[model samples]
Target: MKKRYLVSALLLFSVLSLFIGVTDLTPLDLFSLTEDQAHILWVSRVPRLVSILIAGASISICGLIMQQLTRNKFVSPTTAGTMDSARLGVLVSLMIFTSASPLQKMSIAFLFALLGTFIFMKILDRIKFKDVIFVPLVGLMFGNIISSIATFFAYKNDLIQNMSSWMQGDFSMIMSGRYELMYISIPIMILAYVFANKFTIAGMGEDFSKSLGLNYKTVVNIGLVIVAFVTSSVVLTVGMIPFLGLIIPNIVSIYQGDHLKKNLPHTALLGALFVLFCDIIGRIVIFPYELSISLTVGVIGSGIFVYLLLRSKLGSKSNAS
Candidate 1:
Protein backbone atom coordinates (compact mmCIF):
# COMPACT_ATOMS: atom_id res chain seq x y z
CA MET A 1 0.00 0.00 0.00
CA LYS A 2 0.96 3.62 -0.57
CA LYS A 3 2.58 5.35 2.40
CA ARG A 4 0.27 8.33 2.07
CA TYR A 5 -2.80 6.10 2.15
CA LEU A 6 -1.50 4.19 5.15
CA VAL A 7 -0.68 7.42 6.99
CA SER A 8 -4.14 8.80 6.32
CA ALA A 9 -5.82 5.63 7.51
CA LEU A 10 -3.67 5.56 10.65
CA LEU A 11 -4.51 9.15 11.52
CA LEU A 12 -8.23 8.59 10.95
CA PHE A 13 -8.26 5.52 13.12
CA SER A 14 -6.22 7.21 15.84
CA VAL A 15 -8.75 10.03 16.08
CA LEU A 16 -11.61 7.54 16.11
CA SER A 17 -9.88 5.52 18.80
CA LEU A 18 -9.47 8.53 21.08
CA PHE A 19 -13.20 9.17 20.96
CA ILE A 20 -14.33 5.56 21.30
CA GLY A 21 -15.16 3.79 24.60
CA VAL A 22 -17.88 3.18 27.18
CA THR A 23 -17.51 6.80 28.23
CA ASP A 24 -19.07 9.49 26.03
CA LEU A 25 -16.17 11.48 24.59
CA THR A 26 -15.81 13.02 21.15
CA PRO A 27 -13.92 15.65 19.15
CA LEU A 28 -16.45 18.31 20.12
CA ASP A 29 -15.81 17.52 23.75
CA LEU A 30 -12.19 18.53 23.34
CA PHE A 31 -13.21 22.16 23.70
CA SER A 32 -15.71 21.71 26.56
CA LEU A 33 -14.21 18.76 28.39
CA THR A 34 -15.77 17.60 31.61
CA GLU A 35 -13.28 16.47 34.28
CA ASP A 36 -14.18 12.84 33.80
CA GLN A 37 -13.95 13.06 30.02
CA ALA A 38 -10.54 14.67 30.22
CA HIS A 39 -9.35 12.00 32.61
CA ILE A 40 -10.57 9.25 30.34
CA LEU A 41 -8.93 10.79 27.29
CA TRP A 42 -5.57 11.37 28.89
CA VAL A 43 -5.45 8.46 31.27
CA SER A 44 -6.91 5.56 29.36
CA ARG A 45 -7.72 6.01 25.69
CA VAL A 46 -4.56 7.84 24.67
CA PRO A 47 -2.23 5.33 26.30
CA ARG A 48 -4.12 2.41 24.79
CA LEU A 49 -3.82 3.94 21.31
CA VAL A 50 -0.10 4.57 21.77
CA SER A 51 0.50 1.06 23.11
CA ILE A 52 -1.40 -0.51 20.24
CA LEU A 53 0.65 1.38 17.66
CA ILE A 54 4.00 0.66 19.27
CA ALA A 55 3.30 -2.99 20.05
CA GLY A 56 1.91 -3.61 16.58
CA ALA A 57 4.68 -1.87 14.65
CA SER A 58 7.49 -3.20 16.80
CA ILE A 59 6.30 -6.81 16.86
CA SER A 60 5.68 -6.75 13.11
CA ILE A 61 9.20 -5.46 12.48
CA CYS A 62 10.58 -8.07 14.84
CA GLY A 63 8.88 -10.67 12.67
CA LEU A 64 10.43 -9.14 9.55
CA ILE A 65 13.90 -9.30 11.06
CA MET A 66 13.46 -12.95 12.08
CA GLN A 67 12.19 -13.94 8.65
CA GLN A 68 15.20 -12.26 7.08
CA LEU A 69 17.76 -13.74 9.44
CA THR A 70 16.34 -17.25 9.28
CA ARG A 71 15.36 -17.05 5.58
CA ASN A 72 11.88 -18.32 6.38
CA LYS A 73 8.56 -16.61 5.77
CA PHE A 74 6.72 -18.14 8.69
CA VAL A 75 9.26 -17.90 11.51
CA SER A 76 8.30 -15.29 14.14
CA PRO A 77 8.20 -14.78 17.88
CA THR A 78 4.97 -16.77 18.08
CA THR A 79 6.45 -19.56 16.00
CA ALA A 80 10.02 -19.38 17.30
CA GLY A 81 9.51 -19.74 21.04
CA THR A 82 10.57 -16.15 21.76
CA MET A 83 7.28 -15.00 23.27
CA ASP A 84 6.77 -18.21 25.18
CA SER A 85 10.24 -17.95 26.63
CA ALA A 86 9.56 -14.34 27.51
CA ARG A 87 6.46 -15.48 29.34
CA LEU A 88 8.55 -18.05 31.11
CA GLY A 89 10.95 -15.30 32.06
CA VAL A 90 8.06 -13.34 33.44
CA LEU A 91 7.12 -16.43 35.40
CA VAL A 92 10.65 -16.64 36.69
CA SER A 93 10.48 -13.06 37.83
CA LEU A 94 7.25 -13.71 39.65
CA MET A 95 8.39 -16.90 41.30
CA ILE A 96 11.95 -15.98 42.20
CA PHE A 97 11.60 -12.26 42.55
CA THR A 98 8.09 -11.90 43.78
CA SER A 99 8.46 -8.20 44.44
CA ALA A 100 10.28 -7.32 41.27
CA SER A 101 9.43 -4.07 39.50
CA PRO A 102 8.02 -4.04 35.98
CA LEU A 103 11.28 -2.98 34.40
CA GLN A 104 13.14 -5.73 36.22
CA LYS A 105 10.55 -8.25 35.14
CA MET A 106 10.90 -7.06 31.56
CA SER A 107 14.67 -7.37 31.85
CA ILE A 108 14.43 -10.95 33.00
CA ALA A 109 11.99 -11.71 30.23
CA PHE A 110 14.27 -10.17 27.59
CA LEU A 111 17.16 -12.39 28.68
CA PHE A 112 15.11 -15.55 28.37
CA ALA A 113 13.65 -14.42 25.07
CA LEU A 114 17.15 -13.85 23.76
CA LEU A 115 18.27 -17.28 24.91
CA GLY A 116 15.15 -18.94 23.49
CA THR A 117 15.52 -17.29 20.09
CA PHE A 118 19.19 -18.32 20.00
CA ILE A 119 18.24 -21.92 20.64
CA PHE A 120 15.62 -21.85 17.91
CA MET A 121 18.21 -20.55 15.44
CA LYS A 122 20.57 -23.34 16.46
CA ILE A 123 17.78 -25.85 15.88
CA LEU A 124 17.20 -24.26 12.48
CA ASP A 125 20.86 -24.90 11.67
CA ARG A 126 20.59 -28.62 12.38
CA ILE A 127 17.39 -29.34 10.48
CA LYS A 128 18.08 -31.37 7.33
CA PHE A 129 14.87 -30.83 5.34
CA LYS A 130 14.32 -27.09 6.03
CA ASP A 131 11.01 -26.99 4.15
CA VAL A 132 9.13 -23.69 4.43
CA ILE A 133 6.06 -25.34 5.94
CA PHE A 134 8.10 -27.55 8.24
CA VAL A 135 10.27 -24.80 9.74
CA PRO A 136 7.57 -22.85 11.57
CA LEU A 137 5.92 -26.10 12.58
CA VAL A 138 9.14 -26.96 14.33
CA GLY A 139 9.16 -23.56 15.95
CA LEU A 140 5.56 -24.00 17.05
CA MET A 141 6.44 -27.31 18.63
CA PHE A 142 9.43 -25.80 20.38
CA GLY A 143 7.37 -22.90 21.68
CA ASN A 144 4.75 -25.32 23.00
CA ILE A 145 7.40 -27.17 24.94
CA ILE A 146 8.54 -23.96 26.61
CA SER A 147 4.93 -22.96 27.22
CA SER A 148 4.18 -26.34 28.74
CA ILE A 149 7.08 -25.95 31.12
CA ALA A 150 5.93 -22.48 32.04
CA THR A 151 2.42 -23.83 32.65
CA PHE A 152 3.67 -26.66 34.78
CA PHE A 153 5.67 -24.31 36.95
CA ALA A 154 2.87 -21.79 37.07
CA TYR A 155 0.48 -24.43 38.35
CA LYS A 156 2.93 -25.78 40.89
CA ASN A 157 3.72 -22.35 42.27
CA ASP A 158 0.10 -21.17 42.43
CA LEU A 159 0.87 -18.43 39.93
CA ILE A 160 -1.40 -19.69 37.18
CA GLN A 161 -3.83 -16.81 37.70
CA ASN A 162 -1.03 -14.28 37.50
CA MET A 163 0.50 -15.97 34.49
CA SER A 164 -2.78 -15.96 32.63
CA SER A 165 -2.57 -12.19 32.18
CA TRP A 166 0.47 -12.51 29.91
CA MET A 167 -1.07 -15.40 27.96
CA GLN A 168 -3.42 -13.08 26.04
CA GLY A 169 -2.87 -9.57 24.72
CA ASP A 170 -5.08 -6.93 26.26
CA PHE A 171 -5.15 -3.12 26.18
CA SER A 172 -7.83 -2.45 28.74
CA MET A 173 -5.46 -1.77 31.62
CA ILE A 174 -2.97 0.43 29.79
CA MET A 175 -2.51 3.87 31.29
CA SER A 176 0.19 6.51 31.72
CA GLY A 177 2.21 4.76 34.39
CA ARG A 178 1.66 1.26 33.05
CA TYR A 179 2.60 1.75 29.41
CA GLU A 180 5.90 3.66 29.59
CA LEU A 181 8.05 0.55 29.28
CA MET A 182 6.93 0.20 25.68
CA TYR A 183 8.95 3.29 24.78
CA ILE A 184 12.03 1.07 24.94
CA SER A 185 10.95 -0.24 21.55
CA ILE A 186 11.14 3.19 19.92
CA PRO A 187 14.92 3.36 20.14
CA ILE A 188 15.18 -0.33 19.30
CA MET A 189 13.15 0.27 16.13
CA ILE A 190 15.46 3.13 15.13
CA LEU A 191 18.46 0.89 15.77
CA ALA A 192 16.90 -1.75 13.52
CA TYR A 193 16.55 0.84 10.76
CA VAL A 194 20.20 1.83 11.08
CA PHE A 195 21.27 -1.79 10.66
CA ALA A 196 18.66 -2.72 8.07
CA ASN A 197 21.11 -3.26 5.24
CA LYS A 198 23.38 -5.33 7.46
CA PHE A 199 20.44 -7.56 8.35
CA THR A 200 19.53 -7.95 4.69
CA ILE A 201 23.12 -8.95 3.93
CA ALA A 202 23.17 -11.41 6.80
CA GLY A 203 19.92 -12.85 5.49
CA MET A 204 21.75 -13.75 2.28
CA GLY A 205 23.66 -16.37 4.34
CA GLU A 206 27.06 -16.62 6.04
CA ASP A 207 29.12 -17.55 3.00
CA PHE A 208 27.82 -14.69 0.93
CA SER A 209 28.24 -12.27 3.84
CA LYS A 210 31.88 -13.27 4.46
CA SER A 211 32.60 -13.03 0.73
CA LEU A 212 31.56 -9.38 1.00
CA GLY A 213 33.69 -8.88 4.20
CA LEU A 214 30.71 -8.70 6.50
CA ASN A 215 30.90 -10.08 10.05
CA TYR A 216 28.10 -12.57 9.58
CA LYS A 217 27.94 -13.82 13.14
CA THR A 218 27.90 -10.36 14.71
CA VAL A 219 25.16 -9.15 12.39
CA VAL A 220 23.03 -12.20 13.06
CA ASN A 221 23.49 -11.77 16.81
CA ILE A 222 22.49 -8.12 16.53
CA GLY A 223 19.38 -9.04 14.57
CA LEU A 224 18.44 -11.74 17.07
CA VAL A 225 18.95 -9.31 19.95
CA ILE A 226 16.66 -6.81 18.28
CA VAL A 227 13.96 -9.41 17.75
CA ALA A 228 14.22 -10.71 21.31
CA PHE A 229 14.11 -7.27 22.93
CA VAL A 230 11.06 -6.19 20.94
CA THR A 231 9.29 -9.49 21.57
CA SER A 232 9.86 -9.29 25.32
CA SER A 233 8.77 -5.67 25.56
CA VAL A 234 5.53 -6.28 23.68
CA VAL A 235 4.79 -9.55 25.42
CA LEU A 236 5.37 -7.88 28.78
CA THR A 237 3.24 -4.84 28.00
CA VAL A 238 0.50 -6.26 25.81
CA GLY A 239 0.70 -10.06 26.12
CA MET A 240 1.22 -12.77 23.53
CA ILE A 241 0.01 -11.50 20.18
CA PRO A 242 0.38 -14.57 18.02
CA PHE A 243 0.99 -14.48 14.26
CA LEU A 244 1.64 -10.71 14.20
CA GLY A 245 5.38 -10.88 13.54
CA LEU A 246 4.75 -13.74 11.11
CA ILE A 247 2.04 -12.26 8.90
CA ILE A 248 2.72 -8.51 8.64
CA PRO A 249 6.17 -8.87 7.14
CA ASN A 250 4.96 -11.55 4.75
CA ILE A 251 2.21 -9.23 3.54
CA VAL A 252 4.69 -6.39 3.08
CA SER A 253 7.17 -8.63 1.27
CA ILE A 254 4.52 -9.60 -1.28
CA TYR A 255 4.09 -6.02 -2.54
CA GLN A 256 7.24 -4.28 -1.33
CA GLY A 257 9.78 -6.90 -2.32
CA ASP A 258 12.50 -8.34 -0.04
CA HIS A 259 14.50 -5.18 0.58
CA LEU A 260 14.53 -4.73 4.37
CA LYS A 261 15.11 -0.96 4.43
CA LYS A 262 12.54 -0.24 1.77
CA ASN A 263 9.86 -2.36 3.42
CA LEU A 264 10.36 -1.07 7.01
CA PRO A 265 8.07 1.93 6.66
CA HIS A 266 5.30 0.00 5.01
CA THR A 267 5.56 -2.86 7.47
CA ALA A 268 5.40 -0.51 10.44
CA LEU A 269 2.48 1.45 9.02
CA LEU A 270 0.54 -1.62 7.95
CA GLY A 271 1.15 -3.27 11.28
CA ALA A 272 -0.16 -0.28 13.22
CA LEU A 273 -3.08 0.07 10.85
CA PHE A 274 -4.00 -3.58 11.25
CA VAL A 275 -3.88 -3.55 15.05
CA LEU A 276 -5.89 -0.32 15.18
CA PHE A 277 -8.46 -1.84 12.86
CA CYS A 278 -8.65 -4.95 15.01
CA ASP A 279 -8.89 -2.90 18.20
CA ILE A 280 -11.74 -0.89 16.73
CA ILE A 281 -13.57 -4.05 15.79
CA GLY A 282 -13.09 -5.52 19.23
CA ARG A 283 -14.42 -2.38 20.90
CA ILE A 284 -17.51 -2.02 18.73
CA VAL A 285 -18.40 -5.64 18.12
CA ILE A 286 -19.38 -6.31 21.68
CA PHE A 287 -20.41 -2.71 22.29
CA PRO A 288 -19.01 -1.66 25.69
CA TYR A 289 -17.47 -5.03 26.43
CA GLU A 290 -14.20 -5.61 24.53
CA LEU A 291 -12.34 -8.47 23.00
CA SER A 292 -8.64 -8.80 23.75
CA ILE A 293 -6.21 -7.77 21.02
CA SER A 294 -4.76 -11.29 20.94
CA LEU A 295 -8.13 -12.87 20.23
CA THR A 296 -8.90 -10.56 17.31
CA VAL A 297 -5.38 -10.67 15.87
CA GLY A 298 -5.14 -14.43 16.34
CA VAL A 299 -8.43 -15.05 14.58
CA ILE A 300 -7.53 -12.77 11.66
CA GLY A 301 -3.81 -13.46 11.53
CA SER A 302 -4.26 -17.24 11.53
CA GLY A 303 -6.52 -16.93 8.48
CA ILE A 304 -3.94 -14.83 6.63
CA PHE A 305 -1.21 -17.29 7.63
CA VAL A 306 -3.15 -20.18 6.15
CA TYR A 307 -3.63 -18.23 2.93
CA LEU A 308 0.10 -17.56 2.72
CA LEU A 309 0.86 -21.23 3.32
CA LEU A 310 -1.49 -22.29 0.55
CA ARG A 311 -0.10 -19.63 -1.76
CA SER A 312 3.43 -20.80 -1.09
CA LYS A 313 2.45 -24.43 -1.66
CA LEU A 314 0.76 -23.62 -4.97
CA GLY A 315 3.68 -21.50 -6.16
CA SER A 316 6.10 -24.30 -5.37
CA LYS A 317 3.93 -26.83 -7.22
CA SER A 318 3.69 -24.56 -10.28
CA ASN A 319 7.45 -24.05 -10.29
CA ALA A 320 8.00 -27.82 -10.10
CA SER A 321 5.56 -28.50 -12.92
Candidate 2:
Protein backbone atom coordinates (compact mmCIF):
# COMPACT_ATOMS: atom_id res chain seq x y z
CA MET A 1 0.00 0.00 0.00
CA LYS A 2 3.00 2.25 0.31
CA LYS A 3 3.51 4.72 -2.53
CA ARG A 4 7.11 3.62 -3.08
CA TYR A 5 6.12 -0.02 -3.43
CA LEU A 6 3.34 0.74 -5.91
CA VAL A 7 5.68 2.98 -7.90
CA SER A 8 8.34 0.25 -7.93
CA ALA A 9 5.87 -2.39 -9.10
CA LEU A 10 4.49 -0.12 -11.83
CA LEU A 11 8.01 0.60 -13.11
CA LEU A 12 9.03 -3.06 -13.07
CA PHE A 13 5.89 -4.22 -14.87
CA SER A 14 6.20 -1.38 -17.37
CA VAL A 15 9.76 -2.42 -18.17
CA LEU A 16 8.72 -6.05 -18.53
CA SER A 17 5.83 -4.98 -20.74
CA LEU A 18 8.26 -3.24 -23.09
CA PHE A 19 10.16 -6.45 -23.86
CA ILE A 20 7.55 -9.22 -23.46
CA GLY A 21 5.73 -9.29 -26.77
CA VAL A 22 5.49 -11.80 -29.65
CA THR A 23 8.47 -9.93 -31.04
CA ASP A 24 11.85 -10.83 -29.55
CA LEU A 25 13.03 -7.54 -28.04
CA THR A 26 14.58 -8.38 -24.72
CA PRO A 27 16.79 -6.09 -22.67
CA LEU A 28 19.73 -7.67 -24.45
CA ASP A 29 18.33 -6.55 -27.78
CA LEU A 30 17.90 -2.98 -26.56
CA PHE A 31 21.60 -2.33 -26.84
CA SER A 32 21.88 -3.32 -30.51
CA LEU A 33 18.35 -3.34 -31.82
CA THR A 34 17.75 -4.05 -35.48
CA GLU A 35 15.53 -1.64 -37.40
CA ASP A 36 12.47 -3.85 -37.10
CA GLN A 37 12.97 -4.31 -33.36
CA ALA A 38 13.37 -0.58 -32.86
CA HIS A 39 10.34 0.10 -34.98
CA ILE A 40 8.23 -2.42 -33.03
CA LEU A 41 9.49 -1.04 -29.74
CA TRP A 42 8.68 2.52 -30.71
CA VAL A 43 5.50 1.95 -32.68
CA SER A 44 3.61 -0.92 -31.09
CA ARG A 45 5.05 -1.86 -27.69
CA VAL A 46 5.60 1.60 -26.23
CA PRO A 47 2.23 2.86 -27.39
CA ARG A 48 0.49 -0.12 -25.80
CA LEU A 49 2.38 0.46 -22.57
CA VAL A 50 1.50 4.16 -22.52
CA SER A 51 -2.19 3.51 -23.20
CA ILE A 52 -2.32 0.92 -20.42
CA LEU A 53 -0.86 3.31 -17.87
CA ILE A 54 -3.06 6.23 -18.84
CA ALA A 55 -6.22 4.19 -19.23
CA GLY A 56 -5.73 2.39 -15.92
CA ALA A 57 -4.98 5.50 -13.91
CA SER A 58 -7.66 7.58 -15.57
CA ILE A 59 -10.49 5.07 -15.18
CA SER A 60 -9.55 4.24 -11.60
CA ILE A 61 -9.62 7.90 -10.73
CA CYS A 62 -12.89 8.26 -12.55
CA GLY A 63 -14.39 5.51 -10.39
CA LEU A 64 -13.03 7.06 -7.23
CA ILE A 65 -14.64 10.37 -8.12
CA MET A 66 -17.96 8.74 -8.96
CA GLN A 67 -17.94 6.80 -5.71
CA GLN A 68 -17.27 9.98 -3.80
CA LEU A 69 -20.01 11.96 -5.52
CA THR A 70 -22.60 9.22 -5.10
CA ARG A 71 -21.45 8.27 -1.57
CA ASN A 72 -21.48 4.62 -2.59
CA LYS A 73 -18.53 2.28 -2.49
CA PHE A 74 -19.78 0.32 -5.49
CA VAL A 75 -20.65 3.04 -8.00
CA SER A 76 -18.30 3.21 -11.01
CA PRO A 77 -18.40 3.96 -14.71
CA THR A 78 -18.78 0.27 -15.56
CA THR A 79 -21.58 -0.15 -13.06
CA ALA A 80 -23.08 3.26 -13.77
CA GLY A 81 -24.05 3.02 -17.45
CA THR A 82 -21.30 5.49 -18.41
CA MET A 83 -19.29 3.04 -20.51
CA ASP A 84 -22.36 1.41 -22.02
CA SER A 85 -23.76 4.75 -23.10
CA ALA A 86 -20.43 5.62 -24.64
CA ARG A 87 -20.47 2.35 -26.54
CA LEU A 88 -23.92 3.24 -27.91
CA GLY A 89 -22.58 6.61 -28.98
CA VAL A 90 -19.70 4.86 -30.75
CA LEU A 91 -22.16 2.59 -32.54
CA VAL A 92 -24.05 5.65 -33.71
CA SER A 93 -20.89 7.15 -35.16
CA LEU A 94 -20.00 3.95 -36.95
CA MET A 95 -23.43 3.72 -38.53
CA ILE A 96 -23.56 7.41 -39.44
CA PHE A 97 -19.97 8.45 -40.11
CA THR A 98 -18.95 5.43 -42.12
CA SER A 99 -15.46 6.90 -42.53
CA ALA A 100 -15.11 8.82 -39.27
CA SER A 101 -11.69 9.41 -37.79
CA PRO A 102 -11.10 8.34 -34.21
CA LEU A 103 -11.38 11.86 -32.80
CA GLN A 104 -14.63 12.54 -34.56
CA LYS A 105 -16.02 9.25 -33.29
CA MET A 106 -14.92 10.02 -29.73
CA SER A 107 -16.53 13.44 -29.83
CA ILE A 108 -19.93 11.90 -30.46
CA ALA A 109 -19.34 9.16 -27.93
CA PHE A 110 -18.42 11.70 -25.27
CA LEU A 111 -21.68 13.59 -25.63
CA PHE A 112 -23.83 10.49 -25.29
CA ALA A 113 -21.79 9.25 -22.35
CA LEU A 114 -22.26 12.53 -20.57
CA LEU A 115 -26.00 12.48 -21.23
CA GLY A 116 -26.44 8.92 -20.03
CA THR A 117 -24.50 9.63 -16.86
CA PHE A 118 -26.60 12.72 -16.19
CA ILE A 119 -29.78 10.73 -16.57
CA PHE A 120 -28.52 8.06 -14.20
CA MET A 121 -27.83 10.72 -11.59
CA LYS A 122 -31.30 12.17 -12.05
CA ILE A 123 -32.84 8.75 -11.58
CA LEU A 124 -30.73 8.27 -8.49
CA ASP A 125 -32.15 11.53 -7.16
CA ARG A 126 -35.73 10.46 -7.81
CA ILE A 127 -35.30 7.02 -6.31
CA LYS A 128 -35.88 6.83 -2.58
CA PHE A 129 -34.66 3.24 -2.17
CA LYS A 130 -30.94 3.94 -2.38
CA ASP A 131 -29.41 1.09 -0.41
CA VAL A 132 -25.64 1.16 -0.77
CA ILE A 133 -25.75 -1.72 -3.22
CA PHE A 134 -29.06 -0.77 -4.80
CA VAL A 135 -27.75 2.34 -6.54
CA PRO A 136 -25.19 0.64 -8.76
CA LEU A 137 -27.63 -2.19 -9.41
CA VAL A 138 -29.87 0.46 -10.88
CA GLY A 139 -26.94 1.73 -12.87
CA LEU A 140 -26.26 -1.76 -14.17
CA MET A 141 -29.87 -2.09 -15.28
CA PHE A 142 -29.72 1.30 -16.93
CA GLY A 143 -26.55 0.32 -18.72
CA ASN A 144 -28.12 -2.91 -19.98
CA ILE A 145 -31.03 -1.02 -21.49
CA ILE A 146 -28.66 1.30 -23.32
CA SER A 147 -26.54 -1.65 -24.43
CA SER A 148 -29.63 -3.48 -25.69
CA ILE A 149 -30.70 -0.53 -27.77
CA ALA A 150 -27.21 -0.27 -29.22
CA THR A 151 -27.21 -3.96 -30.05
CA PHE A 152 -30.63 -3.74 -31.70
CA PHE A 153 -29.64 -0.85 -33.94
CA ALA A 154 -26.27 -2.41 -34.62
CA TYR A 155 -27.90 -5.61 -35.76
CA LYS A 156 -30.32 -3.81 -38.07
CA ASN A 157 -27.66 -1.50 -39.57
CA ASP A 158 -25.15 -4.32 -40.05
CA LEU A 159 -22.67 -2.49 -37.82
CA ILE A 160 -22.50 -5.17 -35.15
CA GLN A 161 -19.00 -6.11 -36.26
CA ASN A 162 -17.75 -2.55 -35.81
CA MET A 163 -19.69 -2.22 -32.57
CA SER A 164 -18.16 -5.39 -31.16
CA SER A 165 -14.63 -3.97 -30.93
CA TRP A 166 -15.56 -1.40 -28.26
CA MET A 167 -17.50 -4.04 -26.33
CA GLN A 168 -14.29 -5.34 -24.74
CA GLY A 169 -11.04 -3.63 -23.96
CA ASP A 170 -7.80 -4.65 -25.73
CA PHE A 171 -4.32 -3.11 -25.93
CA SER A 172 -2.92 -5.26 -28.72
CA MET A 173 -4.32 -3.02 -31.43
CA ILE A 174 -2.74 0.14 -30.07
CA MET A 175 0.00 1.41 -32.36
CA SER A 176 1.41 4.97 -32.45
CA GLY A 177 -1.13 6.54 -34.78
CA ARG A 178 -3.96 4.49 -33.33
CA TYR A 179 -3.58 5.25 -29.58
CA GLU A 180 -2.93 8.96 -29.22
CA LEU A 181 -6.59 9.60 -28.35
CA MET A 182 -6.14 7.88 -25.00
CA TYR A 183 -3.92 10.71 -23.88
CA ILE A 184 -7.05 12.87 -23.51
CA SER A 185 -7.69 11.04 -20.27
CA ILE A 186 -4.39 12.22 -18.82
CA PRO A 187 -5.40 15.88 -18.54
CA ILE A 188 -8.92 15.01 -17.43
CA MET A 189 -7.39 12.91 -14.63
CA ILE A 190 -5.10 15.79 -13.66
CA LEU A 191 -8.19 17.98 -13.44
CA ALA A 192 -9.81 15.40 -11.13
CA TYR A 193 -6.82 15.55 -8.81
CA VAL A 194 -6.93 19.34 -8.78
CA PHE A 195 -10.57 19.37 -7.67
CA ALA A 196 -10.18 16.49 -5.25
CA ASN A 197 -10.94 18.42 -2.07
CA LYS A 198 -13.98 20.08 -3.53
CA PHE A 199 -15.24 16.67 -4.59
CA THR A 200 -14.66 15.34 -1.11
CA ILE A 201 -16.67 18.18 0.42
CA ALA A 202 -19.34 17.80 -2.22
CA GLY A 203 -19.64 14.11 -1.44
CA MET A 204 -20.78 14.86 2.08
CA GLY A 205 -24.20 15.72 0.59
CA GLU A 206 -25.57 18.55 -1.50
CA ASP A 207 -26.97 20.26 1.57
CA PHE A 208 -23.72 20.03 3.49
CA SER A 209 -21.69 21.37 0.57
CA LYS A 210 -24.17 24.14 -0.14
CA SER A 211 -24.10 25.15 3.53
CA LEU A 212 -20.37 25.64 3.10
CA GLY A 213 -20.94 27.92 0.06
CA LEU A 214 -19.85 25.35 -2.52
CA ASN A 215 -22.00 25.00 -5.60
CA TYR A 216 -22.85 21.34 -5.09
CA LYS A 217 -24.55 20.81 -8.43
CA THR A 218 -21.62 22.37 -10.25
CA VAL A 219 -19.14 20.08 -8.57
CA VAL A 220 -21.20 16.97 -9.17
CA ASN A 221 -21.73 17.88 -12.82
CA ILE A 222 -17.99 18.38 -13.25
CA GLY A 223 -17.35 14.96 -11.75
CA LEU A 224 -19.87 13.37 -14.14
CA VAL A 225 -18.29 15.11 -17.11
CA ILE A 226 -14.85 13.88 -16.18
CA VAL A 227 -16.15 10.34 -15.78
CA ALA A 228 -17.95 10.45 -19.11
CA PHE A 229 -15.01 11.97 -20.98
CA VAL A 230 -12.52 9.46 -19.63
CA THR A 231 -14.91 6.58 -20.13
CA SER A 232 -15.63 7.55 -23.74
CA SER A 233 -12.00 8.18 -24.63
CA VAL A 234 -10.88 4.87 -23.18
CA VAL A 235 -13.71 2.96 -24.85
CA LEU A 236 -13.17 4.65 -28.21
CA THR A 237 -9.45 3.96 -28.06
CA VAL A 238 -8.96 0.67 -26.13
CA GLY A 239 -12.53 -0.61 -25.72
CA MET A 240 -14.47 -1.33 -22.51
CA ILE A 241 -12.28 -2.54 -19.67
CA PRO A 242 -14.49 -4.51 -17.32
CA PHE A 243 -13.95 -3.45 -13.71
CA LEU A 244 -10.59 -1.75 -13.53
CA GLY A 245 -12.31 1.33 -12.13
CA LEU A 246 -14.69 -0.48 -9.76
CA ILE A 247 -12.26 -2.67 -7.81
CA ILE A 248 -9.11 -0.58 -7.74
CA PRO A 249 -10.51 2.41 -5.86
CA ASN A 250 -12.31 0.21 -3.30
CA ILE A 251 -9.09 -1.72 -2.68
CA VAL A 252 -7.26 1.54 -2.17
CA SER A 253 -9.88 2.88 0.27
CA ILE A 254 -9.64 -0.19 2.53
CA TYR A 255 -6.04 0.73 3.40
CA GLN A 256 -5.89 4.43 2.60
CA GLY A 257 -9.19 5.67 4.08
CA ASP A 258 -11.74 7.74 2.15
CA HIS A 259 -9.85 10.94 1.51
CA LEU A 260 -10.09 11.44 -2.24
CA LYS A 261 -7.21 13.89 -2.53
CA LYS A 262 -4.85 11.82 -0.38
CA ASN A 263 -5.72 8.62 -2.20
CA LEU A 264 -5.49 9.90 -5.80
CA PRO A 265 -1.85 9.11 -6.46
CA HIS A 266 -1.92 5.66 -4.83
CA THR A 267 -5.15 4.84 -6.67
CA ALA A 268 -3.54 5.90 -9.94
CA LEU A 269 -0.35 3.91 -9.34
CA LEU A 270 -2.01 0.68 -8.26
CA GLY A 271 -4.48 0.91 -11.14
CA ALA A 272 -1.66 1.23 -13.66
CA LEU A 273 0.32 -1.57 -11.99
CA PHE A 274 -2.68 -3.88 -11.82
CA VAL A 275 -3.49 -3.35 -15.49
CA LEU A 276 0.13 -3.88 -16.48
CA PHE A 277 0.33 -7.10 -14.51
CA CYS A 278 -2.87 -8.41 -16.11
CA ASP A 279 -1.62 -7.38 -19.56
CA ILE A 280 1.69 -9.20 -19.07
CA ILE A 281 -0.13 -12.35 -17.99
CA GLY A 282 -2.41 -12.03 -21.00
CA ARG A 283 0.54 -11.74 -23.35
CA ILE A 284 2.36 -14.77 -21.95
CA VAL A 285 -0.63 -16.98 -21.10
CA ILE A 286 -0.55 -18.70 -24.48
CA PHE A 287 3.15 -18.09 -25.17
CA PRO A 288 2.84 -16.60 -28.69
CA TYR A 289 -0.80 -15.42 -28.42
CA GLU A 290 -2.58 -12.94 -26.09
CA LEU A 291 -5.71 -12.78 -23.93
CA SER A 292 -6.63 -9.15 -24.39
CA ILE A 293 -6.76 -6.59 -21.51
CA SER A 294 -10.51 -6.88 -20.93
CA LEU A 295 -10.52 -10.66 -20.49
CA THR A 296 -7.59 -10.73 -18.09
CA VAL A 297 -8.89 -7.81 -16.04
CA GLY A 298 -12.42 -9.21 -16.07
CA VAL A 299 -11.42 -12.57 -14.56
CA ILE A 300 -9.26 -11.08 -11.83
CA GLY A 301 -11.49 -8.10 -11.11
CA SER A 302 -14.61 -10.24 -10.85
CA GLY A 303 -13.00 -12.33 -8.14
CA ILE A 304 -12.01 -9.23 -6.21
CA PHE A 305 -15.52 -7.82 -6.68
CA VAL A 306 -17.07 -10.95 -5.21
CA TYR A 307 -14.83 -10.62 -2.20
CA LEU A 308 -15.93 -7.04 -1.75
CA LEU A 309 -19.56 -8.05 -2.01
CA LEU A 310 -19.23 -10.82 0.60
CA ARG A 311 -17.29 -8.58 2.94
CA SER A 312 -19.96 -5.91 2.78
CA LYS A 313 -22.80 -8.35 3.33
CA LEU A 314 -21.07 -10.03 6.25
CA GLY A 315 -20.22 -6.71 7.79
CA SER A 316 -23.85 -5.63 7.61
CA LYS A 317 -25.04 -8.91 9.10
CA SER A 318 -22.57 -8.66 11.93
CA ASN A 319 -23.67 -5.13 12.72
CA ALA A 320 -27.31 -6.21 12.75
CA SER A 321 -26.70 -9.21 14.99
Task: Name the candidate that leads on TM-score.
Answer: 1
lDDT of each residue in 1-321, candidate 2, tens digit only: 799999988999999899897778889898999999999999999999999999999999999999999999999999999999999999989888889998999999999999999999999999998898899999999999999999999999998888889997989999999989988888898899999999999999998999999999999999999999999999999999988889999999999999999999999999999999999999999979899899999999999999999998999999999
Task: Give the range where candidate 2 is weakest over 10 consecutive residues by summed lDDT.
Answer: 21-30
Candidate 2 Cα misplacement greater than 4 A, ranges: none
Which of the numbered candidates is closest to the native, going by highest lDDT? 1
Compared with the true structure, what per-residue lDDT tens digits does model 1 show for residues 141-233?
A: 999999999999999999999899999899999998999999999999999999999999999999999999999999999999999898888
Worst 10 residues of 1 by lDDT: 228-237
Q: After the best TM-score superposition of candidate 2, give how far the Cα of residue 318 lies from its true spot, in angstroms.
A: 2.7
Tell me the lDDT of model 2 at 158. 91
Question: What is candidate 1's TM-score against the reference?
Answer: 0.99
TM-scores of all predicted structures? 0.99, 0.98
